[model samples]
Target: MSKRRFIAALIGVLVAPLLTVVMPAGTASAHGWITSPASRQEQCRAGTVSCGEIKYEPQSVEGPKGLRNCHGNVGRFAELNNDGKGWRVQNVSRTTTFRWNLTARHRTSTWEYYIGGARVASFNDGGAIPGSTVTHNVNLGRTGRQKLLAIWNIADTANAFYVCVDLNIS
Candidate 1:
């Protein structure tokens, strides 16, 4: 190749990846966390559990919908998937109120709560934007120490946000 053409091609190859890194697809416009019951990320953020990079971005455990684990299937926050991480199990009542603190609200499809892989409760939003703080009074029918999974499904995106809370239900 000619000198000028070769240099231009080299620059193009070098800058393309940089541009991709600089501007990733589907930038996160909205994020939230289960703040009341203290999800695994919250435990990391509160220093109750020694965790990894998830402590820095607790509200970013985002992944595809229908995932059953904590960390939202994201590798950086994989520490959340460790059930033996000594997460503080908060004592709660049979009917507990779960709260979410949103950084930026999105059109929500629904909010689901699960225990032992079974959905205990869900509130359908029908694709409506929610407030900064959302609450759901869910009847966690079962008792004893349980790992509860909460999911925030976005209406317009193929991804969903996930958080897991260790609860000692009475």
Candidate 2:
């Protein structure tokens, strides 16, 4: 083959794999959210409520694990943390099941649920990779309306995803 043609072929071989490695397929699908009882983001995704950019990518609200804000501290998803955004509260039993719809599973540290200002339930994953779908049954143990915060902690990362769910328990 000609030297110029050989050089061009070599460049393609080197650059093609780097491009794939830099941007792997489905890397955008790297997390999830609580779908059951519908977190605010889920409500946006389902058209139960109007929202901003989060409506397009509800599973992407990742932030530090210890914070108590929605949008996972992401400014673009800040609408999720808004109190007067007209989110519909879902009615549930005292004991309700939360379902996580995971697009990409990661090694998880824990899953925590909080109501008002108190932690009511937590599941420890012990650094194991979780399934695409996860469910947790939480005993709310109280009646009336409440706002719930659900957190998914990643074992290997310094971040977690957050979801704020409104509920009316009976």
| Leading candidate by TM-score | 2
lDDT of 2 at 162: 92
**Candidate 1: clashing pairs of residues:** none
TM-score of each: 0.83, 0.85
Alpha carbon deviation, residue 122, candidate 1 (Å): 0.6
Instruction: Residues 1-170, candidate 2: write the lDDT tens digits.
Output: 99999999999999998998899565477589989988898999998898877888889999987988877889989888788989999999999999999988989999998888789999999999988899999998789999999999999999999999999999
Clashing pairs in 2: none
Across residues 129-150, which tens digit of lDDT does each residue of candidate 1 receive? 9999999999999999999999
Clashes of each: 0, 0
Superposing every Cα of model 2 onto the true structure, what RMSD results?
3.8
RMSD of every candidate to native, in Å, equals 4.4, 3.8
**Per-residue lDDT of 39 in model 2:** 86
In model 2, which runs have C-alpha deviations exceeding 4 angstroms? 1-27
Q: Which regions in candidate 1 have their CA more than 4 angstroms from the true location?
A: 1-30
